[model samples]
Target: MTALIEIHNLSFSYTGAAPHDVFSQVSFSVAPGGVFCLLGPNGTGKSTLLKCVSNVLQGWHGAIRLDGRDISRMKPADVAMGIGYVPQNQNSAFPFLVRDIVVMGRAPHLAVFASPSTRDREIARAAMETVGILSLADRPCTTLSGGEWQLALIARALSQEPQVMILDEPTSHLDLGNQVRILRVVKSLAGTGMGIIMATHVPDHAFIVATEVAIMNRGGLSRKGAPETVITESNMRDAYGIDVKVLHVAGGVERKACFPSL
Candidate 1:
């Protein structure tokens, strides 16, 4: 597997915030055709690291290279062309149509002051089709449920044709069914040779879809390996402050299931 993104010694610190820096000297690489899961408690630097990889926040301490290009020196538009970033929340003012919102994702490729061409629209349409949201193309964004909104956001990112996608809690605020739906979509995307890095609170998501898992601990990524190895009892307790029984559910194949150790 080719490395799509390389993060070396990545570190960040909010100006004048307590503890100074959130995490430091964190390093990892994301390979194509794989899903890398970042799991940890809130504020442990998972979301911040995603933002750094997506180029949403700058001035970090290390280097992030996307397909061998040094991302720290790249312009925002250049980064946008290669990496699609889906933040935790979004708001729309006028209830834009789903297709229109997806088309906006082509901004990185479009010339300044130029509108989306027919080809751009075609790409957006294809992206919607890829995510199984073509039926909602004409629907108002405001009318969609939480699950639909999340899928729409993913469709927008897909429209970017990014080599790698960085998502911050894609399943957050979603119902159980929606969460499973989104995870299935993620697994399908990885199957198609795209590198995916998703920050998730649900360790089960990683256990299910991630080829590799990284658990943020004590201000950096302390555990990294196969999901089965990383999502262990001790790691879960350390990262989440909860005891979970990692169980195997016998079915079509062996699948690991986690539950609170109550």
Candidate 2:
């Protein structure tokens, strides 16, 4: 199958007084129904690369294509129609209802100056239900806990019904249970043939849900392969500069985990 998203020789740098490269020569692809995860330490440009893919940042030296169409030339609305991006959540001062917030995702599908139609509302409702947040529809966004707010953002992106989803640290700052919930949602979404690319600090997350994984550092992605192959002790030490033990438990529902060897 053709890749849903492709990036070749991608490089970016912030232009300012003390300019420096965030990452260079990064290449990857996400196939339909694939979960691609980027693992790295803080400030390693994982988030920057995601922004470039989403077209939120520009002037990079590389090519990004969605279904063989160059994203640089696509209109912003077209990008939104193809890729749903969920950036790190921020609190909004205005207390919009959750349903209204999710309905905003329909903007890309509606004509200019047009309001959301009944079908759009129905789609938004389905999106909410998919993320298990339909009960929060009437609640104000400001009243949500961190986990609830994150689910709302995911619902908003889901309402777009895009082919691919880009999530920047979807599990960040959440408790263990919520993190697992989000990971399960990610896997479930991919099971439905929506490509997912996520940047995360947790190595175990990649092991849990990623069909493919890459460890990114300052220069670029250092390793890319299946999670068990790419997220080993050596790569973890090289990427994070800390010793970690990658463990496999053979009990009920076997799984892999990472622990710092402090």
Candidate 3:
């Protein structure tokens, strides 16, 4: 299968008091219809890498190609059209209607000063239905719960109709049921040939839905392979500095970590 997005020898650094580098010579690719997970501890640069792939960060020292073309050469609008980004826990301070928020995804296709056409509304409604939140379309975004807000954000992303979807901690603020629902929606979308790259702190998400796993540590990709190959106990320890016991589950491995004795 051809890769929908490719990263080759990518490197990025942030300006700080001490000038810290977040990534160094990172390389990976996401194939069409593939579900890839980025796993690591806090401050491991997972979100930075996702932003680079989505073209939100610029002047990186390597290549990011989309459909075999250089992403740097693509305009921001074009990039937004090709890649849909669902950020983590977007708190809308103002009360925007849910339908208005979803319709913002169509900005790439909209003419300036023109209202969304009937087709746009149809697409937005369809995307909302896909995320199982069509009933909340008219509600205020701020009035929704965390899970409802997440579903609405995803609905907005789906409304973009991109070839690849990049989610940064999609299930971060949700409870177990909401987490399952979000992951189920993401899995179902991947089944329909949408390439997905999601940064997740939860190992269970990768165990259940990810076709491939990339473990990041110390500003680089330490392991990349199928879930079985990459998410072992030793790898977990290495990446997270935790001693974990790996259990063989019905379909995948369950990870249990041991804390240091006092």
- Using TM-score as the measure, the top candidate is 2
What C-alpha lDDT do the candidate models reach, one value each? 0.88, 0.91, 0.86
- Alpha-carbon deviation at 97 in model 3, angstroms: 0.8
Query: Residue by residue across 59-172, what tens digits does model 1's lDDT show?
Result: 787889999999978888899988998778867889999999999899999889999999999999999998889999999998998889898999899888998988889999
Can you give the lDDT of residue 68 in candidate 1?
94
- Which one wins by lDDT: 1 or 2? 2
Candidate 1 has its poorest 10 consecutive residues by lDDT at: 12-21
Candidate 3 segments whose C-alpha is farther than 4 A from its true place: 16-20, 250-262
What digit string (tens of lDDT, one per residue) describes model 3 on residues 54-97?
88777677888888989888878788887999988578889999
* Model 2 per-residue lDDT tens digits across residues 1-262: 8999999988888872224378888999999999999998888888889998988888887899999999988988899999999889659899999999999999899889899999999999999999999999999999999899889999999999999999999999999999999998999999999999999989889888999999888769989999999989898888888899999967784888999978
- Candidate 2's error at 204, in angstroms? 0.9
